[model samples]
Target: MTSRSRHTAAALALLTLAVACSTGDGAPAAAPSGPPASGRAAKDVHVAFVGAAANLNFSQEMMEGAKYAGQELGADVQVVAPPGPDGQAEVGLFQQVVATAKDGVSVMTLNPELFTRPAADAIAKGVPVVAADVPLAKDSGVTTLVSNDNPAAGAMLADAVLTRLPAGKKGTIVLGVPTPGLPVLEARLKGMKERLLAKNPGLEVLGPFDSKQAPDDNYKAWSGLVRAHSGALAFLDAGDPAAFNLPKIKQETSASWLCAAFDLNDAGLAAIKSGQSVGVADPQHWLKGYVATRLLIERALGKREIPKGFWDSGAAMVTEDNVDEVIARQKGPEARAAWYKKLIDEQFADVQGRMKPLS
Candidate 1:
């Protein structure tokens, strides 16, 4: 979904490598000071996600994670974004972030080569940067990456479909994708198509439609496919855009179809709860933001050092049966606080604290 920001399209065009967020009240509120355990307080640590827009479930949740970590670590952090969905647009936004970012910058990269330079420049200049979603190029002299294993998660979605369909049933499947070149999205499509349709001559497959088009275009494309292929059994979507509209499309077109896609938001969870869709691959984007912010602040404050490598930001499966659990765990301050503690324990328990070339 796109937002109408005050940022001009012309200004959005000049973006190049990018980077972090602010308080809930839209003010620059630093963390409240307390006993300084490290004899150093973390202040002015900025964490940013590309394509940040109001009410965007993924980015918004990530910002909340960062804010939570900032409060815990006594870090003054803020989140920022650029007009996006366009990779190049993020590059311009990141460059601007680097120009004035504070003690540390936690960034999520999209366009690799374009992003590497600015992020690298920040790292070179003594501003610690942590990458999430899509990490900076491995050789960029930056360390720490937080994101789901895309292809593996894609494989898991495909597995969910096979498990859901009745045995000996061969049903037509439709694949939906938002855009090309995004490694995660592309990996999802690649993994699904290869596994779901392998040597199944009786199975029919539809277009990996260019879903990056406007919402109307996506609705048109998806509704048309669902109608023509009413017999289709599984709608395997590779991006959130497809999943966001699938329930509505099926509802309006009177097509009851099994579907799967990446990410989960309130509406998406509702779709699952209503049985309008089956499962979604949850990348735990909030964890990425929270962890990235925490790590950046610790490293910036000289309280800790991040091991240089991928952090394998894990994923989860959300089906109707267990969707309620995810819904509950992600709500309220108490639940999130508990979830963050478990995450830190599971992900950062043991490490050699050394840098190695990315695998």
Candidate 2:
């Protein structure tokens, strides 16, 4: 059918369905009107997503993609998020979600050691589990981790920073990371630092900043480093959100410096577009969320054992040249709808008929 015809049919069908439904008191109830209801109740698979609240946009994108997959598989995807960026609250939220004994769980391991035993216990009790953003180590109980190649991601950032510097200019470069021991962020930081230092012998590496990847804190730490070392040439921010605020630092400081950043959010995208930020790296989170959900639903449907391994979802760098394309692709509601469609097509290819979304 033509697009217009299809839309009209959908509208009429929704109107008819609305009239057929009754209220709790036997009066006509206001029916939800839009696309058809997602067949979430049909499939018994239950998936849980646990993530930090401060990274709402990032977490929401992953959940949105997963929910897209769940709709395609007619599975129910339950997302239990912590209150905010507080690590303690995140731990508490995980405990609550695991206690519910959902069929499947996909958690972002901000603190793997803290959650490993608890996650393992949930797995031991027969709940299939996976990790996202940060992966579980060999001893961790998660069945799989959907993440990017951190070292490679770091290398990309370093490459961008080095490319902009004068061929022979030598100065200290400060690398900012979320935490000292966070394997993922550290891997990237190490890769960037080592690669840059290897090529430039005269460069002095100031440090791996201990800032918790919070914007305000990062600004203070980064600004202090820049001020202390008037000779510093570049700044490496491991995440994009922090990278987005580099303009303020540049405006306030009288020194000229280069910056390499990662991830894409509204602020980060705008920063790149306006040339305030040098680069933002993406791990193709849209694909990660889509694939992770598919793996979970596959196990639930076929009684297959959950797959456990590290999958590098992949990464891409956005600079001044392609910032517009990146930002344009993520413009609004259509962007999400397109991502959901892609997830459904790529992950649920085998179960085309069963694939659907929950409203």
Candidate 3:
């Protein structure tokens, strides 16, 4: 099969998986805007996945999802990212990509405010833009947003920590992220802080420290935070797996700090298994990329109507109690293959059945 044919085939497979895993009682999955067709769009639609280079795993999964969509739609998909930690470099890269006037572009929107003008210019040039993992309403040029239900996910994180904390009273919990001013990180912190405040009246959110999304930096930042806030009862890692691997710091600290992190990868899974972290809030990131590309493909191909608003692919809660079952539920590409499989097996079975005719 050609790349386009492969992606179309994968899209059929993915819809099957999404429907199967989403519903509890094996209900049929809902239909998406796009349907498989005989001919690809005349114009080759180009899709781009933009984000941080340092965090390769997440972006790579997002790219894979986009590529899957691109292959199905006969799109030319490109994954572009900033070379380093500098947000300014990312801004420049966005300008360069937007300047090209690609057919469709999906960005992570790490800092929406900075990219708003350039994003608007891209839209003016006829590039339909979608922001992922972060909302960009401030950028009127952005057509849609693909994200998780972050605050609810944040609340889920808080609940995990609260469940482990001392009974009947809230204690101080530190929130860790990659940075302070970045839009996505800020939203996550806002959601987490709100959830922590609402659930445990006695619970106080202490730090939104910059973990830098690096393992060593996670170790260092966490070490200092734990030392300064020795009374802290819990730690909420709002971003990556590195935050969960703080056992060394936890061991040295006088206070017993319970941990809760977002998402699960090998490291985060290991941390949960070791009993170091209590639970995780997974945003079903693969779905975010998969659906975003699906919507764009449908639009570019004139196959269906494109919605004006955004889509929240939603998040799934995984705790130490359920980690084994969750891990058992996956098959395929290690990056997103398992989630895609679970989707097919669970939520989208009805949609899966419908797709058979197209295949």
Candidate 4:
């Protein structure tokens, strides 16, 4: 099915589930008068999950987490995204959700500034908003931010690259950014360059060249860069498309440059297993989605006060040593949710304690 059709089907299914779990008056079914009830107080709550692009693997992984959270919490989670990274289109969707969402909305965007006003308005209208993946500004009026520490993840990627290079190696490394000027990507690139230079001043870091958001265009951009910089020591990317495409390019061209990027798309995993790329810096997208939705549900149910700051969703590095384990954990939505159950319980148990000021 087409991407739009898939999104429609998923939303409809979640809505149907929500209705089935509600009472005739459209209120959540009352908990049984016995021992403490399981955590399904959000039976009729409707939460919206908005993403920057529907076609990207990172976004799909996040949607999976959102859907799984709905299943676990008995909430209705509707997912939507633009076909590509169109910030304007994403802002429009966020505005619409803010006006209509019954419970709350969680949005992941490349352009957080575009969302500031709409998010503030949503908060004023009693609709909570959580910034997922890319964080909004400190005063964006979002209930909380669930995302990886992008700069730290970037430095981690640089450290991974450093392992592949010899000490005092004097060579070039190219950085590809699927969306230039994106706060998260720029922060990651900044951290990476700084780390790389600090560790190996002899290394020459090249452009965070614009690797377009569309898959086809992104591949083309990486392919052109590889061809133009045949002698570069390594290629690192701050986006998902490159994680999948760079390995393909490396294999097809029989290039010797080390390749690494962010995200754990299937192709990228395969590349790691086959030793085509060094590793991927995982932003834990699924966890971010689940945390955002769960927080919104808790707020709607009056179970908890959603924190108003940055909640570090965490990050990881997927390499040959742990690729199989990561693959097993990601076998399906249920498996992914189960794997994160402990972490979720801990974080939700002390939401405020886990949050740090949004910097």
Highest-lDDT candidate: 4
lDDT of 1 by residue, 187-238 (tens): 7788777766663545666767666533456667777777777888978777
Predicted structure 1: clash tally: 12
In model 3, the runs with Cα more than 4 Å from the true position are 1-43, 54-57, 72-74, 96-101, 137-140, 251-255, 325-338, 341-359
Per-candidate local distance difference test: 0.66, 0.63, 0.61, 0.81
lDDT of 3 by residue, 1-359 (tens): 67644543343233211100111232222245345542544235555656644354455456556655555445556556653344555555555555442656677655667777777887888888777776665545665676766767877777777777666575678878865676655666788888777766777777788776656677788777777877877777777644455644664553467877776566666667777667778877767676676666556656554455546566877887888766664334443544475663443333223221100
Name the lDDT value of residue 303 in candidate 1.
51
- Report the C-alpha lDDT of model 4 over 294-345, residue by residue, as the tens digit: 7777667666667788899889899899999998987887678778877876
Q: Which portions of model 1 show Cα errors greater than 4 Å?
A: 1-39, 44-55, 83-89, 138-141, 198-202, 205-207, 213-217, 352-357
Q: For each candidate, give its TM-score against the true structure.
A: 0.80, 0.78, 0.76, 0.87
CA shift at 301, candidate 4, in angstroms?
A: 1.0
Clashing pairs in 4: none
